[model samples]
Target: MNIARPLIQLVSWAILVSSVFLVKALANDSTQNLSIAVGWSKPPYVIALNDTGYEVELARQVFKRMGYSITPVYVPYGRTLSMLKSAKVDAALTLSENTATQTIHLTDSYIQYQNVAISLQSSNFKIKRPNDLAKHSVASFQTATKILGKAYADAIKQVPLYVELPDQRRQVGMLLNGSISVLVMDVNIFNHLHSALEPIESRQLVSIHNIFPPSHYHVGFLNSELKEQFNRALNDFQASQAYEILVKKYHIFQEALSTH
Candidate 1:
């Protein structure tokens, strides 16, 4: 027997055993660092720049309670799905049970967004529900087609000019200038960032249509066991006084904010 061949065989066996143990160790590690995928600069939810926003911090606290830490990966809303599917990241924020990402496990509804259809008051558009949007041009956040349900999806297809983009601030300008017939967004999101994002050229009154129901979003995970752990932690976090402080910190009320 060649001495080098036997030694190499021994080393390979050790490596294989080590890998198995490592996998088991990580599976049981409570202080694990998770790579979480989240979307771009939507204030009060995801302020991607400094890497700290309402949902971001909320996730941090929830994970912290479980002795886990999060490393947020900022991608566009649409990319979050792909990232999760490809296992490029560990989890995705703001996904719902309705999101069509196959093999992805979802947590309980941790956050709710009051999404609305907004148009200029001058247009006199009577958009009471999603189907009413079929006749007009619309701009909305990325993945709105998937998350807002089938009725909204069908309406978007009928619209002559419908656009969904990651930069929601630009869509606000489009709605104000009459370039787009409607802008679909969360009520708190528009309220928190409109003054800074709106164009100086257009100063127009807006009509908010509560066409869509409140969207309850969950965090997504590729690992099923991790999902169970997260849900347990989330339940504990929600019941704690810390959770109340977090909601108030972000100025997010349990009741929908007045859509004026």
Candidate 2:
């Protein structure tokens, strides 16, 4: 009698194990099949919230529909590239065209924009030309100048006093502190943080008249094999209506669209 009872219990456990396996298989089948890494939120682009921010979220959804498991990594702009170089990450969310040419393989242009140097109104310094900066101190990130050029970078490096800030937001703070006479960064990044740092109305910041050409940003790939797969997926994503939805959802061309 006791042997029969033990046998029945073993049979019941086997059935439960089989059911669990079936459920796992079904779940796996339902999910897409790719692995990706998207960099942290820089805003209006790569957002790093618990919920994917606008553009990054769009990228996530686009890849998910195509079969991808996105791993979002929060990193400094410079570190983002380091990760890519080390193969620790697949691609950076959004980087300038210049960066693409200089660093990673870029996809077709998804977005483009002009970036400029900005300085607080209280400051007497004015930038008429790149050379005008010679007299004053500048706070800039090392990664930023790469987009500008080795010449610009060399010039910055040559300045009598140049403060290197790892974070763009910190550079803004440095501007306010009078530690540096000027701050150089993406215009959009400055605009996004300006309000939080100080009243936009109270402060007078100027964007130099000579524009930095509208630089394109796109999905990047480090490994060529992965790049090809992503390129195909990216093209497929572009052809789908989902792509348009993403552009609108993230307000990708906000600076241009806002005028309308």
Candidate 3:
């Protein structure tokens, strides 16, 4: 090859290598960034499909207070812990010690879900407690089995027909059409979907059973330092006016901390 041509080729290759390194350095700046695994479709808590929801906004605001930005890694509710354990994500939203194994550092309780059993009023389901679900067909939000406590877990095992769905919208529809006898969902989610998918006059069709105790949630972080930072930021943010506004923006109520 001509000397001049070879020299130009060498310079071009070096420049390309330098650019690649630069891009990676910027992209992998873990020190100033965090990737959190969030549920893909629990609207209100997480609508990770579009990345706008209560949990998403909460994480963004809390992490921003900690001098870092956040990127939500949308996954099924079941994958949040695994993703965090595998180092694929810096943290996982909407998880707690009960919903996890001994793998990561869990932040303080930052959110709560008032999980309840809902059914058609016509069904007359005598579901006054978790065990009552055993006699009926039930569809609940995915990960409910693990997060809803031991009593709920043991009760679901006795269910004649039980299923877990990632999005409650379908389960809500199932409950509405009498396909399923009961739906275990967050109250806010039930109300939100009910409003959107049915007529106001049809609101009386379902009965919401406030049987399950509220599920408190925390963020699982890969490292203790991050956990500490996040918890501190979470506490500070939850005490600020901005957090009040955020709660109002999402219309969170007493039982619907994870609003829809």
Candidate 4:
């Protein structure tokens, strides 16, 4: 009976050790790592330096709040949608509602973009409406036609000289060099690019018009459950001071205008 008691005690100790290790393993498994697709070198949104930007920080905070870790996968803007559709990434950030595919679930708007038409102050251009763009040479970001809506797309079709470039920087350069009479881009992005220019050059550029309405961007997710969780977390974030902090840090509301 003495040997039997010791044997039973040994078994209990072994079970306790096993349970501890099992719980630890399950804990590790419970902490999920989410991958998010973001555009490369899109300043104030996806800065490539340390993979830190407004959207990057926002996503990090949102997922962290939801008890998960996030990894941002940088890709070109055009490829982000395909990557999401193919399940290459858990979600894609900074996508407008007009651009989101039907198959993927979209979360609430986490960011807003003020897209505008820019031209040189010397050009004497006036772009009060989409139709007004038909009279000028234009350069715009890729997929902008679809995202800007059918009216803008139809207007661009009427433009005799129109080109869609993949890089915002190139569009800015083209506008400065007089290669394109007008450039369309987010106000923040234009400001970011303009800051790199010489003071003399910056003074000459101007945002002619805010033809396109402000676009609200959402995160696209292939998994519906993840989208629901993100929306809840995003709503909570918007109600918190953290959201205001991010907006101010990024200068999100500042309209696109000439530096001068």
Clashes in each model (backbone N, CA, C under 3 Å)?
A: 0, 2, 0, 0
Model 1 misses residue 128 by how many Å? 1.0
- Compared with the true structure, what per-residue lDDT tens digits does model 3 show for residues 133-172? 7888889977788777777888888878889987778888
lDDT of 4 by residue, 131-224 (tens): 8999898999878897898889999999989998767788888998889898888888888777776385536657558787888889998888
**TM-score of each candidate?**
0.81, 0.72, 0.82, 0.85
> Which regions of candidate 4 fall more than 4 Å away from where they truly are?
1-27, 99-102, 200-202, 258-260
Which of candidates 1 and 4 is the stronger one according to TM-score? Answer: 4
Error of 1 at 56 (Å): 0.5
Measured over all alpha carbons after superposition, the RMSD of each candidate to the real structure, in angstroms, is 7.3, 4.6, 5.5, 3.5
Model 3 TM-score on a 0 to 1 scale = 0.82
Taken over the whole model, the C-alpha lDDT of each candidate is: 0.84, 0.63, 0.81, 0.83
User: Which residue pairs in model 3 clash with each other?
Assistant: none
Where model 2 places Cα greater than 4 Å from the true spot, the runs are 1-16, 29-41, 95-106, 110-113, 122-129, 200-205, 208-210, 218-223, 238-252, 255-260
Ranking by TM-score: 4, 3, 1, 2
Q: Which ten residues in a row have the lowest lDDT in candidate 3?
A: 251-260
Q: Rank the candidates by lDDT, best first.
A: 1, 4, 3, 2
Model 2, position 248, has a per-residue lDDT of 79
lDDT of 2 by residue, 101-163 (tens): 544787666555455666656564556656666667887655656676665676676678886
